[model samples]
Target: MAAWLLAPQFTRSCHRQTPLTACKSNLKNIGTALEMYSTDWSGHYPPNLNLLTPNYLKTLPECLNAERVTYRIATGLNAPLNHGRFQDYYLVECTGTSHQDVNIPADYPKYTGIMGLIEQ
Candidate 1:
């Protein structure tokens, strides 16, 4: 007969591993949410950071990165150049890629993000 045992260290390792794995998971979700918003004809991008939640992340064990969202915005800072040129929109992940405090909007309850006009 073979017996299987998990060492105490393994337990600790699992605890440690969970967050990192979770963080990655959260990041992926953030990316996915942005993708969804991009396709949807919302007439704009996802709402501001203050409006995000798990509802956005279909992938369980949420992990979001809030700090990154603002900086990403700069990527699309320049938009709406011409007189009749419709401004471009952007999908951002401001939070820390974790579901820490993703605002839960009744409508798009998951992804908390910002939308801005930018140039192609």
Candidate 2:
């Protein structure tokens, strides 16, 4: 009886966290793809994420939110680069406020909903 009463709340919490988990996974995958692409392109990142498909990634990853927002790339001048080459890029989520229930990554700025590969 007690377990049954708490099941709904647990389910709802998990449901709410699903999108966030997917988003983080998507970001990590994309980051790996970007690094692979850069490794093949003389340390230069692609101008667009679509270039990663069929080679670095099987397909582009999308946000799993209610709006199903597509991820956006912020590269070149919009992102920090290494030695004037596009060695870094920022992948931003649409709407930017849909995933705030959890802690943002230390490398990622707060409330920006942006993830990226920054060359150290």
Candidate 3:
């Protein structure tokens, strides 16, 4: 009888977990695609995530439940022509969970600038 009573609670918790798991998977794939893109482009990272599509990635992965996942590359005209060699690159995913958002590569190099996302 107690197991039956707990079943519904368990199911609800599982349902809530699904999107979070999928979001993490998407981040991993995006990271792989970025690595490939860097290799092909003389170690330069894509200016935007869309640049990876149909070449490095078949199609960009959508955020599971949040608005969208964001890609931020810290490179510029005078920036060194290499990803991770001299600059900081990051991916941010807004979550459906109460945690708000999570940044891929949780660790970052010292003195990295905060790249803000414009509210849409």
Most TM-score-accurate candidate: 2
TM-score of each: 0.33, 0.56, 0.50
Model 2 steric clash pairs: none
Assess candidate 1 and give its TM-score to the true structure: 0.33
**lDDT, candidate 2, at 36:** 69
Per-residue CA lDDT of candidate 1, range 1-120, in tens?
A: 112221213223435544334443343445555545445534444444222233443222322233233222211334222233334444333233233343322212222233221111
- Give lDDT: candidate 2, residue 95: 36
Q: What C-alpha lDDT, on a 0 to 100 scale, does residue 93 get in candidate 2?
A: 39
Better of 1 and 2 by TM-score: 2
Assess candidate 3 and give its TM-score to the true structure. Answer: 0.50
| Higher-ranked by TM-score: 1 or 3 | 3
Off by over 4 Å in 3: 1-17, 67-85, 88-92, 95-120
Candidate 1 lDDT (Cα, 0 to 1): 0.33
Candidate 2 Cα lDDT to native = 0.50
Q: How well does candidate 1 score on lDDT at residue 115? A: 28
Sort all candidates by TM-score, best to worst: 2, 3, 1
